[model samples]
Target: MDIGSEYLKIVIKRFKEAKVTAEKAIEQLTESELFWAPNEESNSVAIIVKHMSGNMVSRWTDFLITDGEKPFRNRDDEFMGDIQTKEQMMELWEIGWNTFLNGLKSIEEEQLLKTITIRNEPHSVMQAIERQMYHYSYHIGQIIYVAKFLKSSDWKTLTIPRKK
Candidate 1:
């Protein structure tokens, strides 16, 4: 495979890995725990999921032709703790990943150098992909941290145990 193809595959694999890691952490939490926030300023897991989903849909839908920040996206509303159930949260999570993964899969090797706009800011396709990769990874870390904090003694290590 060419370098572009290899790069795409790696990006997909990394994203899938991040998604699974977050899901594993989420599976350990109760529905109420998913909405728990340490402070008024902090976001709950549900809110984070909602925001990610919104971002994915806005950024990935018609990714090449349209701006990454869609006109219809209400980024501010995503932060509201409105996800009523774990099921709802999971549904949003799946939608976001599906949009992102499908969008990534659709890219051709030649498109990697093409410029795209996010909020009217120009970025090469590679740069845009890396941006989302970092963004999602950051949020997934937050989810894992919050889950660990909530689970405390009951938390199962997502990675190898500290001593093992």
Candidate 2:
């Protein structure tokens, strides 16, 4: 199996789909609903959005040169859930995703073979993309879970219908 640029594009496609899913899940929520969490240890939908945005920004921006963890990323604050409006969350989410996609779009095929330092160890672009795919998928699952938890009885499926 020869993996190449199309593989990267596939990852991007998944991210796009994941983004849409996250958005739809949040669309089901109200401002008060975003604050809903079943337990003291669980995260609210707002907190999930914050954490996902924070993670996206940290891992995607300066992807080629810097460690995945950015100095500007506030990992702790992401769990605090102080943001009151969905608009604010969406803006941050869009910014983070745009930055990530822009960075990914900028990479050339040759650069994909070059090693980039993620934490302290070196990872090829393929490895880095793989790492991020799992990471984002993990958080996206969290967002979906929180949304479902908040929606409870009235939850609706967000997946688009197949054309006959």
Local distance difference test values of all predictions, in order: 0.96, 0.82
TM-score of every candidate: 0.98, 0.88
lDDT of 2 at 32: 84
The lowest-lDDT stretch of 10 consecutive residues in candidate 1 is: 1-10
Candidate 2: TM-score?
0.88
lDDT of 2 by residue, 1-164 (tens): 43667777787888899889888888888878877888889888778778877887888788888888888887999999688787887787888888888878888877888888766788998798888789888888888888877777888877654462
lDDT of 1 at 18: 93
In candidate 2, the residue pairs with backbone N, CA or C atoms under 3 Å apart (3 or more residues apart, or in different chains) clash, namely none
- Return the lDDT, model 2, position 106: 83
Best by TM-score: 1
Give the true-structure RMSD of model 1.
Answer: 0.6
Q: Write the per-residue lDDT of candidate 1 for residues 1-164, one digit (tens) a residue.
A: 69999999999999999999999999999999999999999999999999999999999999999999999999999998888999999999999999999999999989999999999999999999999999999999999999999999999999999989
